[model samples]
Target: MLKKSPVSRLENLWDDSEAVGMSEPEKLLYRSNLLGSDKRVTNYGGGNTSAKVVERDPLTGDEVEVLWVKGSGGDIGTIRMDGFATLYMDKLEALKGLYRGPEHEDEMVGYLPHCTFNLNTRAASIDTPLHAFVPRRHVDHVHPDAIIAIAASANSKELTQEIFGDEIGWLPWKRPGYELGLWLEKFCRKNPEAKGVVLESHGLFTWADEAKVCYETTLRIINRAIAWFEEKTADTAAFGGEKHPSLPPEERRRIAAALMPAIRGMISEDQHKVGHFDDQNAVLEFVGSHQMEALAALGTSCPDHFLRTKIRPLVVDFDPASPDIADTLDRLRGMVESYRVDYAAYYDRCRHDDSPAMRDPNAVVYLVPGVGMITFAKDKPTARISGEFYVNAINVMRGASAVSEYRGLPEQEAFDIEYWLLEEAKLQRMPAPKSLAGRVAIVTGGAGGIGSATAERYLREGACVVLADIDAEALSATRENLAGRFGPDVVRAVEVNVTSEEAVAAAYADMAVEFGGVDIVVSNAGIASSAPVEDTTLELWNRNMSILSTGYFLVAREAFRMLKAQGIGGSMVFVASKNGLAASPGASAYCTAKASEIHLARCLALEGAPEGIRVNVVNPDAVLRGSRIWQGDWLDQRASTYGTDKEGLEEMYRQRSLLKRSVLPEDIAEACYFFAADTSAKSTGNIINVDAGNVQAFTR
Candidate 1:
């Protein structure tokens, strides 16, 4: 069950009952979770909390003061005890003597590991020194939207003086590091009674000797800001008031669906990127605001916001007043290229000598004046997080601009942090992406044995998959199973019958909106019909053709449309049967439809070759294990035709093959994966027979 906020004033969710008998570090964890719970308090991974505790030193057997702070890249909201880096406060204090001023501060990070308490494996974040240097035993540093609104104001210092009057102090912006830590230490020493300090254009930092007091102090300070903004903006216009009306919700999604794939294609030329589309109220309000272009041009205020979202978003050329999606598509390529060129210029102008080479220049956030926002990134979660961060920035802008002029970080300063040697190292340390990291796949008959297996294979390799199946219940189950393992962000389910043109088209369009565009298409939907040619009714023949042949064509046609639109080469794997090549007795309808599937794939391969779309086939024979088709009358007929009971049918097919091995769904899945992956980059219009060496199914 979702926890309800206890108070209306900015979510005071702390319950005394929940904090009983907790250790200092445990209290710190609890406090951190509370502050990080609401986005209004802090976005994901945006804040840090610390507590100093007395602990017996592993080496000296004497009590020592230790600072436990959230570790690098860890989210406070979901952080565990192991996620904190435990360091000796004495060691951190002793390092002040070694500090060679601001210029040499980057070297301080190298000594952090030396201070590791009890040899904890968690790496200390850059903010560690800031926590250690503070005189208070507990400190809460968070980027609350309400407080950031005050911090990001042009007259921020004056506003700070008016709001909390010295109870909470204000400091000019400084890049967070060893130097800032010392600066904060000096500030605390001078203002002994000050409860907290707001870092200009950054966030709030509150501290108290008691952990509970510290948590409440942070909440109270944020609530004050919220109250101030509410009272002040009650009569004022936000973001210079709305300049453009928001498109209707469905219309907004339709536009987003149309634009995301095109944007994804342009940006994903070098490395594929997954996408996320958000049209939440905050997003729509900001995008439709009069000052959106002006403020967005100034860029985000918070460093975390600026990092997740780029310095600025790409304002898509869309006007809800007179919407034309086609015109927007035509102009999108130039706009994207322009953004790249401008980003390159920014990098070239601000880069230090040791800066890493310019990274992907594509804009992470795209704002449509009418239809909310789109974000594309190396993966789905990152894209979604980028959008979330932008929304936070919008909230900051909304409140800040209503009362005072909002300010962004200076360009050179932003560049310094973006290319900071420490940050660059962190980026470099990230593990290599999986092979299908940013690819999106659509699997027809995705709830079936072979289809589900193939979808899992693609998902394991890091591709976002849309499971399209006619059976809603099975699709939901399959999706839940896959989503449980790969995460909900990477798996989606659509109830679709491949035989319906409209359903197939709608599914592809939905897939486009969900994960940007398609990279892989697996056509595995089928029906197995059994009858001698003389006894085959037209209904039986048409049923087989409708599902096996026509369904494959419909799916491929939609896949081709999207593939060409994305301009990113894709892979299509058709799961045919050995009967496509070698006729089977008493199953002429199924065999003929299977042949049509194979031939349809060949034709598509020929047509799609120039577009770099590789069409391939994976054929299997007597794959009775977990096959939905094999559970019906077709199985009985096949068994009767072979003069064997159902129990012995598989043994007959295994012995009949050149290799006496029974085929399973996983065997076919492996073949589909090969064709869908880069391993088969140079091959197309090819068929792999997974029928345990069926000589008759072999290619001529």
Candidate 2:
């Protein structure tokens, strides 16, 4: 059971007496962080908190009560004082006099900005009135999963009485708005002794004279509710089966790989890009359960979840034993189209005159009987977040079913929350997304310096990146580092030997399963070898040819197939060297291999043009600083050939270029991004030389 008192980390922020020197907002900051830090309490930006304080107005020099509530787009985990929007209490509460019901949803949004005590303060969260209407000096609200489980049950009122013994008030489902706030205020007047109110199919609220008391009350109520759940669900046989069943992992992977591409092709609207794919073990177990239909049909366990996961997930009928990929894809396409049609009809039936226009009707989650759950969204992060929320919803639904029949709000109520004007206003306030926000990119040789730099650049442009390399240690390290910045959902590491066709094919198949399909392929995996023609052995030449020439062919062959399956125009970039064009002495093996790779790109470009796939090359020279090719004997030979130290030799190469600047991996990355991104949509079968203005290496 959760502790009845707040987990006070305030001591970490201050010594015994140091807290006395803190300001009211500063105290709330520490308290807010504690509340937001728990995922069970909040997910991403799901909850809000506030404290009542008296401060003098700058103009009037008179005391005023200001409500410091968490602002929109603020995550409590790392929120600062600026995250709290200060509202004049009198000004905000007076709006209750203008109770216009749910129809004034748009008008309520318009009036919020004008209520801010300072014009520069961030917009308060939509639940601001819920905090303002309460009589307590401090309020804390969170969508605890355990609390939601009970509140969404068919016997919610009974459960509330059992858990709180009439100490808490229960309100029926109402679309959140001015009227909901008005109703809460009346409940407080009628039940003055109640510690909190459980909002049906919404969340929980607790209040007290002190911040700590309110917070502790919230946790205590949640903990008691969780205790009731555990006692009721103690019989494992009643819940049935494994929480996660062992359905051959290989078969699950195969099914996801085959189904995602078809789903992407159907949902994608962008000409050159498609959505990302993600799956979870919890979701897989839920779909495999005998009670899958019953639990899912209950709709969203919480109204806020409708914004992420749709009102109900479209369960795609898939058989793991199906033998034909093409046949299976055709069947899934028909099902998905029907899902869209049904969604349109639902919207038409439920919408009011003030309702927002319906959004694209693509199903977010695909529950395959044998294949687990597949989530699709414009980008990997959103897909991953959606998958996570679904997993939690499944848990809540199951928990509720164990206690009583799970009951979510009606479909019309869910529709109201999904298309609420307040959410639209918040979305419109965001900046434009990056160019390749929904695209998936794969970089071969990705643990290497140039490849890693290229992967980083694609992620910066908002593309989901898969780093494929033969070096396991480097691949793992690079993946962990990049995941720290862009999140694990958008960054993945795969071990691939480009020389082996099996390895290359498996890499693309996994990419299809992990991210639907590929929109960009960077072929940079190769080994460098240098020898005079007379001394060049067949073994050395063949080694270079296998890695550089054959590897490029294998990557392109698989990439083109997946892109064609997706029916989306895509980009393939081969990383060649300037030495292919400008012959260097004792570099026959390297130059010959590069030449073959470069020409292969042009040939593939010619064949792919009819399908709108563009193939290009980036030729870079003397990127020696971080390159593995310039180590040991190779470095010695290059320095000996130039008649100078390694440092001086670098300067000589820099001067050889017309621009007189040393080329770096980032310079090559920029050229690759241009070819892969929509910026160079009209260019194809072209070579971009990143040798700092190499005159001889320039494309003809």
Candidate 3:
């Protein structure tokens, strides 16, 4: 059932005299009003409004000037001619053919030149092609709330026909720009008499031979639908309930600012705004009830609305009987995840083709319990409009559900729409590069195979290195050996135990202040202690854990805080042994500690992703040559136990790998560089194996 609002008097502000003998300023004002009257009617810059006029060109004869189609970032309510990019009719129409023969729509949009004056601003509105295709002198496209409400409803097509049966034609949602333009071209060709087009989950397109006709038609359609919907779901008690108390405007603004960073990459700030559904009696009654989870599964009214309102709302339990809000939040998050999985399955079933789905949910409507609904948006206008639409949709869906289960787009079909080419194109934009460059990296246990080789590779790639070891003599000697070849600043010597957090922190802090900031931190410092699971003493376990696990956390935490505060995205690499992935004979403590570090890195990767910080771990197999762990009696004891000579033991280890080659520290360094450089901008929360393909014993 649809709810319709009472029809008000038709307000036509512009008269024939005012329209026919319009001065430039008067015409601009009229155009602004026609475009800006309805917030839900359009997105920030999603739609374009234009008027045609004859103007003189200096070099060309009898030019048809299109008043600046709204340039990017210019709001319609206050937009002026300066906001519009004036283009010659022929020049604008020629763009239709610019992207020919198997070109991606996004690539076409990207190549479109930024408007002449606002070079630094966003490119022109994406609806330029559709507007240009219309022969009408005045054109407008809007994502009107009323139109979208019907479009999102299950009976949308039927509802639309009932409301505007003779005047309107419906167009299925398609990626904006090229695909949409092509669709409209075919549609208009089929129905030349059609005055307007309704794009499902998108908006409405209305054009008229005259500006007043276009404006009047838009209002009439919306008003008619509103009237019909209100009559269908006219329950006087639908909104009866206690209203949630309001928060201070400043407090609301602060909360919005806090949430902005989390969603910035997905939605622009200008497109986001905070709105309160406090006064909505329906919302209050719904939130006060206990069906929060079911209420949240309903999809957003439109896809673009996700940028304004998140795909679902956050249902905060504010009851005094609730034990913990944090726990409640955890449960809600679990619910969100559950809904996401179900939604994905639904999309997969409905999809006719294969395409990856977006991992992030687009809209979230919160059930604030006693606090009412709080909606998030990329910008304020979007937020307000999205909130209103969501509330309205909720009312309608509930009404329909009272009679029967409310159905949504099939799982696969929804997935198809969500993973559509246009949406994926938005993800293809290149992000900024990592900030750490021209800095040095030092890993302790330098003479040890992994440590020494990592240091060597860093030096070759232009990083000054410091190889620190407990053995002062070995440390000094390695420094002397590498200094002549890689330069003195490229390598330094120090003696320190990684077990001491104070020592590790001081060392990294000094290096940061000395080198402008520790751009990269390789916590590749650890001792391999072998003791059978039963024989592993608590004391031995604690020592190994303190040195390997705790030490890495201390070092990484300091580096991350400094790098993040410095506003630079840093890279941290951890070298956990293969023992971290699978159990090794007589190495319980070592395996546990290494496993802990691996988990730590995974957590850091998630937390650091938004900060442009990337964290990854490289698990390398045993590299016996030059490793302190292999030197002295350690290798001989292991070899004797395995009933093989040291050489044979080393060969066996190399043969165990899928590549049939020994894993080297340099191999690990290559994996480190992938996460550290711009080449892997989209790579995070990944663990790469430098173990020459040890498939059986792999890390998750």
Task: Specify the highest-lDDT model's number.
Answer: 1
lDDT by residue for model 3 (1-700), tens: 1123333433444567657887543574576655565443444444567666566665555554644466655666667656775555666666666767434665666654632222324456566667666766777776665667666656666666777885788876565676677777677778778878887656688877666777777777766765665676565333233233334444433333222222222222122212233336556566555444464555554555444444456555445233344455445445545645754565556554546554444334555554456554422334445566566555544443432234333334445556766556555654532232244465767766677777776666656566766777777777787887876544666676776766765565444322323446677877777656787799989988997898888878876765564444657788887778877777788889999999999999999888878888888777676667777656775676567998898788888778889866677767766666557777776788777778756754
lDDT for model 3 comes to: 0.61
112-171 per-residue lDDT for model 2 (tens digits): 776778564688777888888888888887887888887898888888888888788799
Candidate 2 residues lying further than 4 Å off, grouped into runs, are 1-23, 98-102, 118-120, 236-246, 271-281, 321-326
Question: Where does candidate 2 clash, by residue pair?
Answer: none
How many clashing residue pairs appear in each of the predictions shown?
Answer: 0, 0, 42
- Which candidate would rank higher by TM-score, 1 or 2? 1
> Per-residue lDDT of 497-576 in model 1, one digit per residue for the tens?
88899999889889988899999999999878787899999999999999999999999999998899889899999999
TM-score of every candidate relative to the true structure: 0.97, 0.92, 0.48
Error of 1 at 322 (Å): 1.5
Between prediction 2 and prediction 3, which has the larger TM-score?
A: 2
After superposition, the stretches of candidate 3 with alpha carbons farther than 4 Å from their true spots are 1-29, 40-46, 65-67, 95-103, 114-122, 235-279, 285-295, 317-364, 376-700
The lowest-lDDT stretch of 10 consecutive residues in candidate 1 is 1-10
Model 1 residue runs over 4 Å out of place are 1-8
